[model samples]
Target: MSFIRQNSKLVDEFWEKGIVESCPIYDMHGHMGEHYAIYFAAPNADEMVTLMRRANVAKLCFSHHFSLWATPHVGQAPALEAARKYPDILRFYCSINPHYPDQIKQDLAKVGEWIPYCVGLKFLPDYHKIPVSDPAYKPALDFAEALHLPILIHTWNGSPYDGPAVLRDVVPHYPHVTFMCAHCFNNNWTAAGELAKDYPNVYIELTSVPGTRGAIEKMVSICGSEKILYGTDMPWFDEHQGIGGVLAADISDDDIHNILHRNAEKILAPFL
Candidate 1:
């Protein structure tokens, strides 16, 4: 066989046949929702698991589409059902809306009821047009602190509500709660890395960031391998790129192991 055909055969024998296994891999950030129209459609829950399994991800923790696109409760129903069907492979974050304080209370109650199934909480302040610094959002932050659950916030630069600076005010208040700077604060990775260094409770989730090896290496250098995690904003982006970026980074094997799964094991220990 030609070299390309030989390589293709090897790939099929290993990855396709599920014989290639690395250290336990976990996808720390992802979403499943039907509302995502043609341009945004992520796979349904079943297809998501199949995708993860093919990629050798042992566990996946995500939030609902309804929570992000429709309403928190509507988004949660499918997540709950998926958890029931794929309890071993799936975990979820409780979506809490700061705009509706009453609904926030209600969701916290649901989170409490869900127990191990609800591993953490996700906040999309920008999507809801609320700032994390707003006092109205305190209850959700407080609930997460009380339970020691991690909070994954959608962050970006130049946004008054979701910017990295908001954490300066919020992280100090909930020292016990672990805060995942989702997407590495998107366009504001530098500031996000600084926050991770400043706050021991803060962490970096690598989703939707630039896929360059240098970018990944820089993040590892800034945040330390222990605070960095592997997350693909799946259904929107390709997991192969996310996985390949980390693999191609000029980091030690131990660091790769930590980012791929060990750090998540430590952060989500309560649930795992």
Candidate 2:
């Protein structure tokens, strides 16, 4: 069966319930919202569910885009409200930007109150013009360390987009906190491999890296299936393109299962 229909299929097909129950895909690191201009066209809460139902995605983790993460100064009450509005279908991660050092504590506090409901945190350091280990945002690193919440951080590997070197600073402090580094760390994958080896909680997502040769296999070799999870980073990566990328990786079926669904199933289990 086709894993996804076009975004319009959710509205056009009028087969939401059947569609949802029919398929078993679950997108762990995808985002949808109208508030951000980067993903201004991304689905809103309702639209997102319709698409999930259409794609037969059993659950979808709403990883809010880098825009909000970059602008941590903004109030997150509205985003929390939106998550509450779609409780059964949505799960939230508090996105942070360390540049707004004054606001980091307040944001973490608010997120703490929302937890067990809000189970994770996300970071887009590149967009915020910082790296994962930047000293200025040490409060966030420390809080995640203490709280033990999983953080889905953005890391790119190449030009046009840059990322942290070894994630050395944060990894040591937050040994218990789960860090799901997104985008396979772009082209700086060697650093990605090394960090995964060094930090057990440093999980990596096999999102847009499917087309690259041996990328998924290399990550699996270094980080293992359990540490690698399925992700689409959708709209930026199409459903067909994203899923195909993972399948192309020459890994075992079981490992693919972990990346595609099981890892996410495990990650969001507490909140679920």
Best by TM-score: 1
lDDT of 2 by residue, 184-227 (tens): 78765666777777787877776677678878788788767787
Segments of candidate 1 deviating more than 4 angstroms? 1-20, 37-42, 72-75
In order of listing, the candidates' clash counts read 2, 7
Return the number of clashes found in candidate 2: 7
**Mind sharing the TM-score for model 1?**
0.89
Candidate 1: residue 146 Cα off by (Å): 0.8
- Which window of 10 residues has the lowest lDDT sum in candidate 2? 5-14
Looking at model 2, residue 59 earns an lDDT score of 59
Candidate 2 has a TM-score of 0.80
